[model samples]
Target: MTRFARTVAAVALTTALALTAGCGGSDSDADAGSDGKALKKVTYLTSFGNFGRDAYAWVAKDKGFFKDAGFDVTIRPGQGTGGVIPAIVGGQAQFGPIDLTGGLLNMGNGQAKDFVAVAAVQQHTMAAIATTEGNGISKPKDLEGKRLADTPGSVVRNLFPTYARLAGVDATKVKWVNGEAQTLMGTLAGGSVDGIGQFVVGKPTVEAVTKKKAVLLPYSAVIPDLYGNVLITSKKNAENDPESVRRFTAALLKGLEYSLGHTQEAAQILKRNVDTTNPAAAAAELELMAGYVTPKDGSGAVIGSLDSGRVAKSIRLLEDAGTLPKGMTPDQIIDFDLVPKG
Candidate 1:
């Protein structure tokens, strides 16, 4: 079998679980009805803040796509992947928009056995390892032995270790620190850490605070496993509530389409959805996110469709780098049937 076929086969065979995540209880009442008709409630746990999920959150809520799709979608933000899977597995939510790599690792570790990936949101890694220009960490190699701050167990956490190893730098050589999204710039400014893994959206804030340019560490360059935020539903949902899964994914894809097509309007929506403390950061995030918007060909067909070939490459890279265990194939972990085939 081809490598891609092997991966598909592998993901199909795995009996993995998801990590149990915690979050603020969103509407403890399970029977909350939809706007017009009583539709099932679907919880979507986000790994980032309101600003991070602005694209989907605003477009879906403001555009009424979720309601139109017959879902009372509830949005809940999380600190990281630690809260996403549990929010779903523990019945706090029905879906999680989380880091693909962390979700897979959690599955392998048996924290959430029933979770399945439904759709991919962004097409690129929207994060970077920012450093001050004067700090002398100009190139990727300069990161060796530097104080690196990152949130442990986050997507960038898994990505950067592998990236460091790939860059010929020992992952153990650098002092890796756990950091929060709100306090990363402060950490860098205070010299607590020489470099930080920051989202592309926060680049402006980091630049403004430190007066230094950052060396972006694009995941695609080092890790073949660079997958954007993914929509995941429990295996129980996939089997028993396929309709809800379909509705959620369809609505989210609609939101993504609208977000990409209406840049000006989407930006405005983003502004309202996020807080005022980081308007510039939020705007920069949206602007930088433009680079990741999946484009349509001349035939008017979106190219955002799942690439099984890329998935296969990701599996191999993970396995080769020891991020994943040996013999873990794509099929055992992934369910392409949940994704739109056409």
Candidate 2:
């Protein structure tokens, strides 16, 4: 999913596809500001099709945070960060939900304009390998000498082999098979492939539908701590339209807090927003996402909290591992100016 998260299609404006109706508070909650004016509208583009961000959107609308913040917010789902950055830069949308790394890579390659992470939606990585039961694949190393399906350039497909290497498996031994998300689950259930990287949220759903237990290998358990989905916007947008971004971020974080606090209700809302074949599965996945939603208590709950030191560490790791180009600084990969210190 992270690979799909990374290689998502380029951002563009389209007919406003309202997945669920937006919820707002009463007139009192929408009380006028100093000038007694209404809120401004901010359009946001999401980075993936089944990304499951409806939780945040719904919570915000139902909670009146956006109305209080003076924003008429509209959310559009993008296939990947590729599509998101362009849309924001083109002013087709105000900001977008994107992978922080993918957004930075786009900026570094000059494929997109500079942007800031207004808030971190899911700090921990969520992609993982879900395997069929009775395959005797108990651990990460068991994936060796098996077929794994994935699209090329997917974060999971591209990184799994490396992750296997770290887990003491000869990544070359595993056969790479090309397949789509639908086919991957089918293949795994049908015994065509041993396993494939999938979102952990989808694992339980797959098990319920396929009647098979899947072992989800959390990447955080194997590799360096990495940031996942985030609220992103152009540097110009952030600097010139700070109020809009602030309103958007506040509403989004409020949504996150609500979703985290109320999973069962949130899951019901999520099932309605996601692909419909697996409502129970979607509900289960939304529950799984709570891990990504709320950071540990010791860890502050800054929506877009960033650590320059950690980023520098990742740069060194990627450079050493040949994943990132040399001489890339954290500043080149991150724009912390937009995210205020909590």
Candidate 3:
């Protein structure tokens, strides 16, 4: 062959290799500064599918919060505590959300240890059992003999037995069927399931999709201390790249504050990125969630502030409920030093 031909082949091979390497691996080589140079690429997963309840993450990306923090974020749908923890541990994703109660349960049983909670997204647990008007479900006891659809390993599904015991419902009587995160509400709308696992904020979306008023049974009503969603990252990232975690957590909470304050705009921002999101429904969900996003009392604590005392109490609550095993400390799951205080 000719020298020119060999040179051309070499150039093509080099170009192909560069492109492949760029897409395949994480780009964590640069300083975790907001200088906007050599942006570190990372993957984030929502607490669930692209529902309005998880809109803050999208808002962070769309509003340049992640970018401003020197991150090139790729957001994906999460399957809840069961799925997000493993993904972060396995290096498949860098940041995500998971229900704190579920996280505690996982940590208590020693099934999870490689991920840490960085920030609280919603101060109160929003897990609920939702159905339309015709579902004959006005209270938890009504859930008996009903079918519910939800993602496997979802917080709602994992914590239901505890919720059931507290609500005086028969856990064994209700049936839980596996459904994709994106399609759970649709399954409810189509009447394939009597109910769908949801957040209290999801009422508006369920109503819009079913064109019927939604009936909700919030777990918070019975299990008061559970936290809804908390931002998380792998232990390696938290230890080796503490600055990145701090920056990412700050940006995400900023977006959370912005989304709750400006619901319509936040909803439109979410709708722009995810076509399945309805602006009006998204806005309503955000509005419903506003009360749950901050300090429930008049104390004026910051949105993501978490108390070790409260978390310890939460652990005991789970232990009594038979969901979490004995002996899980707040330190096992939370990084108090990294948590936002101001």
Worst lDDT run of 10 residues, candidate 1, spans 1-10
**What would the per-residue lDDT of candidate 1 be over residues 155-271, giving only the tens digit for each residue?**
777666667777776777777788765566667877778887665555556666666675555555665446766777777888897877887788877866666556456546644
The top-ranked prediction according to TM-score is 3
Itemize residue pairs with steric clashes in candidate 3: none
Q: What TM-score goes with each of the models?
A: 0.81, 0.77, 0.88
Please write out the lDDT profile of model 3 over residues 1-342, one tens digit for every residue: 000000000001111211111221222244343674767788888776666666677777777777778887777767678989999999989999898988887777778888999988878888888888988999999999999988778888989999999889899999999986666766887888999888887776677777899898889899888777888998889999899899989988988888877777777776666655567777777778777777756665787988888899999888888888888889889998898885
Full-model lDDT for every candidate? 0.60, 0.60, 0.76
Which portions of model 2 miss their true places by more than 4 Å?
1-39, 50-54, 81-92, 104-113, 150-153, 171-193, 271-283, 300-303
Better of 2 and 3 by lDDT: 3
Q: What is the lDDT of residue 273 in candidate 2?
A: 39
Q: How are the candidates ranked when ordered by TM-score, highest leading?
A: 3, 1, 2
lDDT sort, best first: 3, 2, 1
Error of 1 at 271 (Å): 3.4
